[model samples]
Target: VAVSVSATASHPIPSTLWGQMFEDISSGDGGLYAELLQNRAFQQVTPNTTAALNAWHPVNGATLSVVADTVPVSSALPNSLQVVIPAGKTGPVGVGNEGYWGIKVTAGSTYTASFHYRFPTASAFKGSITVGLQTAIGHSLVSTPVPITAASTAWAQVNVTLRPTASASSTANNFTITLDGAAASGQTVHFALFSLFPPTFKNRPNGMRVDIATTLAEMGPSFFRLPGGNNLVSETVAQRWQWNATVGPLLSRPGRVGDWGYINTDGLGLMDYLNWCEDVGMEAIMAVWSGFALGGTSVAEASLGPYIQQAIDQINFVIGDPAKSSAAALRASLGHAAPFPLTYVEVGNEDFFASSTYTYRWHDFVTALQAEFPNIHFIATSNTFNPILSPNPLQYDVHVYQTPTWFAQNSFFYDGFERNATTYFEGEYAAISTNSSDIFGSPATGRLTFPTMQSSSGEAAFMTGLERNADIVFSASYAPLLNHVANSQWTPNLVSFDAGAVYPSTSYYVQKLFSLNRGDEYLPSTLPNPTGTLFWSVVRKTSTRQIIIKISNTVGTAAPVTFVLPFRTVASTGTAQVYLFPFTTVHDFDVWIPNRC
Candidate 1:
C-alpha cells in the first residue's frame, strides 16, 4: 500500500469513537455489580415457594419461607425470609444463599456482610447471629458473630466483616446467616435486604466486580452508553426503566422487574453509573425511556406530556440546578451537589421496532428537551429518514447485527450518507453469525457462542471506514458489553464472566487496540480493493510524531503487502507493532518488528 504522507489531514478522529454499552441481561446485580448474594432483597418476589426464594435455602433442618411482613423492614422491600428454628434443633440453624451461580471465596480477603432483621412478635432470644462463608458441602471458610441486643419488634440492621483464612478450592460456595438453635428455640425471625460484597473495583460501596471492571478499564473507553439497550424499554410503558426509582439509598429504591424477566435490585442505580463514568474518565451517553415499549406499545400523543416531563426531570437529575428543579434537589440530597457531566441524551433505544409512531414521539420529545437543555445533543434511535422524524434529528443512533462477510462488505456503509449537519452514532453493531439467511437464529444455524477471529477481523475492516468518515460519525460502541456465562440471554458479548473468572472475547481486543492507539488525525492513504479480504486504515498522532496503521486479514493464508511512505524525511529504523489473529485460533498474538523502514 502507498501512503500519502505528504497529503494534509483528511479529518480529525472523534474522541468518542470507541466505548461500551451496558444493560442488565443478568450482567448486573450478579455480574458486574460487586454484590455476591443473588435475590438478596426479595424485590417483586411472590412469597412461599422454592421458586420465590430462588437462591436461599434452609440450613440444618431449619424451615424457611419468604413472607410478606406487615411491618416490613422498609417500604421499598415488602418481603422477607421467615426462618423457624424447630424446638429440638441443637446446632446452628438459619438460611444460606447460593450466590449468583456460586460464591467465590478468596483467602486474605475481607467481605462486608449486612442484613435487616426483626421479630414477628416479642421474644427473649438474645443470642448473636453468625454470618459465614462456606463451601458447597457446608464447610465454613470464615465466620463472624454479630451480637444483637434489641428484642423489640422494630427492625434492626447488623453490619459485620468476614475475613476468610483460606480460599475455597472452587467457586461452588455459599454465604450463610445462622443462629444458635439452643439459644433461640422455636424462634421465628424475618430477614430482609441481605448483602455480601467482596473487595469492590475501587473499594466503593456497592461497586463493581474487581476482575470485570478492571478488564473494561483496560480498554481505555471514552464513553459509556448506559442503563442499557433494549433493557431500557419494557413490554409496557409502566415497566420501563424509571430514573427516579433507581437513585438514592438502596432501602428507599424499590427494585423493578427488568425487561429480561429478572428482579433488578436497583443497587447499581443512576448515581452508580455516573460515578462509574467519573471513575473511568469517560462521558455518559444517557438514554431516557421514550414513550415506546418493546411490546408494540406507544403512549398516545396526548399522554406524552407526562412522559416528556419525566424525561425532563431525568435530565435535570443529571445536569440541573438544585435551586430550581426538584430532581436536581434530590441529586444534591444524595451527595452529588455538582451536576454530572452529560452531553448526549439518547431519546430512545432502537425505536426502529416501532418506527410508525416514532415520528411524533421524536418531535414531542426533542422539541421539549432541546428547549430545556439546548447545549445537550439528543440522538434519535430510528431508521434514518424512514417514516421521517420531525425537527430533522441532529443525530441518529444506528444498530446492525449481521454475518462476518456482511460486515466486511458494508465497510462503505456510511460513505454514501449526505454530508450535512446531521451526524451518526453506530450505537450497536456485531458479527453474530456465519449464516446470512439466519443471522438471528439459534446456534445450530451458525450463530456464534463467542466472538471468533474472522468476526473480529471483519468488524475491524468496518471500523476503518468509520474512522475514514470521522466527520460524519461522531461515536460508535459495541453493544451488550457484558454477559454472565451461566445465565446469558445474548450470545457473543464483548466480555463474559462467571462468579469467579472473567473472559474477554477477540472482539474485545480489537476494540482495545483501536481505542488505546487512537490518533488525532486521519491520514489519507492508498485504498484497498473494494472486494478484497485484506483492508487497512492509517492515522497519525500529531503529538507523538508517529503513524498508526491498522490492518485486518479475514482469511487464514498470509497476504503479503508493503507500505511506501511519501514523507520528506522517512524514518529508516522505526518500530512496527502488529496484532495478528489467525483464522483458526480464538487467541491473538502480538508481533514487534524493530528497525523497520
Candidate 2:
C-alpha cells in the first residue's frame, strides 16, 4: 500500500478527544477509592444479621452484632457494630474487617487507620484497643495499641498509623480492632465509621488508590466524565446519585444504595472527582441527575422545578459565587474557595431509554440551566433528531456497543452526519462481543472476557474515522472504564483489577497510544480503501515539528505499507520513531527510534 501525506493541515484535532468515564460498578467502593475496608460506615444498611456486617467478623469468639443506636455517632450513619466480650475470654476479643475481598499490605507503607467508638452503657473499663493487619490464618504483620483513657457514652475517635515492616505474602489479609478481654470482660462497645487508607495517589485525604490512579494517569487523559454512566441513574429518585449527599465531611454524607447492588460510602464524592481531575491534569465532564431513573420512572413536568433548581445548584457548586449560592458556599467551606473549572455539563445519562419524556425534561432543564449558566455547554444524551429536542441542542452524546466487525464496518459512522452547528460526543463505545445477535449476552454467548487483539484493532480503525471527521466529532471515550476482576457486572472493560493487581487490556494501550500522541492539526492524507483491512490517519504536532502517523492492520498476517512525505524538504538521515504492536501479544508493544524513515 502507498500513502502520501499532504503538507497543509485540514482541521484542528480536539483536545478533549480522549478521556475516562467512571461509575461505581464494584469499581469505586473496592477498586479505585484508597479506602480498604468495605461497608465501613454501614451507610444505608439495616441493623442485625450477618449481611448487615458485610465485611466484619467476630474476633476471638467475641459476639458481634450490627445494632441501631439511638444516639448514633452521626445521623448519616445510624448503624454501628456492637461487640460483647465473653465473661471468661482470655485473648484479645473484638471484630475484624475483611477488606473488599482482602487487604493488600505492602512493606514500608504507612497506613492511616481510624474509627469512631463509644460504650453503649457507661463503664469503668479503661484499656487500650489493638489495631493491626493480620494474615488470613492469624499472623500479625503490624499492630499499634491506642489507649482508651476513659469509657464514655459519647462517641470518640481514634487515629493511628500502621507501618508494615514486611509485605503480606498475598492479598488474603484482614484488619482487626481488638480489645483486651482481661482488662474489661463482659463489656459491650459500639464502633462506627471505620477507615483504613494506604498512601493515596497524591497523599490527598480520602484520595484514590496509588497504583490504579498511576496507571490511569499514564494514559494522559484530557477529561474525566463522572460520577459514572448508568451509575448516575437509580431504581428510584431517592437512591440516585445526589451531588449534595456526596460533597461534605464523610460523617455528614448520607451514603446511598448504588445502582449496583452495594452500599456506597460516598467517601469519594464530588470534590474527590474534581480534585482527581486537577491532580491528573484533566478537566471535568460533570453529569447532573435529570429526574430520570433507570427503572422507567420519570418525575412529572410540574415536579421538575425543584430538580431543575437542584441541577442549577449542582453547577453553582462547581463554578458559582459563594455569596450568591449556598452550594458554592459549601464548596468554599470544603477548602476549595475558588470554583473548579468546568465546561461540559451532560444533562442526563442515556436518555434514549426514555426519549418520549426527555422532550419536556430537556426543555425544562435546558430552559432553566441555560438561563443560569449560559457559558456552559449542555450535552443531550438521546438519539439525535428523534424527539426533536427544543432549542436545538448544541451538542449530542452518542453511544454504541457492538461486535468487532460492526465497529470496523461503521468506521464512517460520523462521516454522514450533517456539517452543522451541533457537534457530537461519542460518550460510550466498546467492542463487547463477537456475536452481533447477542451483543449484551453472557460470556457463553461470545462476550469478551477481556479486550482482545481483534477488538482493539477494530476500535482503532473506528477512531481513525473520528479523527478524520474531527469537525463534527468533538470528543469520544470508552464506557465502563474499570471493573473489579472478581466481581464485575460488565465485561471487556478498559482496565481490570483485583484486591492486589491491575490489568490493562489491549484496548487500554490503544487508547493510550492515541491520547499520548495526539497532535494539534489533522493533516490530509491518502484515504484508505472503503472496504480494506488496513486504515491510517495523519496528524501534526506544531509545537514539536513532529508528524504522527497512526495505522491499524486488522488482519493477523503482516501487510507491508509505505508513506511518501509531500514536504519540500525530506530528512533522509534523521531518526524516525515507531511503536509496533503485533497480533501475537497485542498487550505488549515495542517502541524504538530507527536511524532513518
Query: Largest lDDT belongs to which candidate?
Result: 2
What's model 1's lDDT at 410?
80
Give the least accurate 10-residue stretch of model 1, judged by summed lDDT. Answer: 584-593
Deviation of model 1 at 23, angstroms: 0.9
Clashing pairs in 1: none
lDDT tens digits, residue span 260-356, model 2:
8888888889989889999999999999988899988999999998899888999999999999999999999988989898999999999999999
In model 2, pairs of residues that clash are: none
lDDT of every model, 2 decimals: 0.87, 0.88
In model 1, where do residues sit more than 4 Å from their true spots? 1-6, 582-597
* Global CA lDDT computed for model 2: 0.88
TM-score of 2: 0.97
For each candidate in turn, give its C-alpha RMSD to the true structure in angstroms: 2.1, 2.1
| CA shift of 22, model 2, Å | 1.1
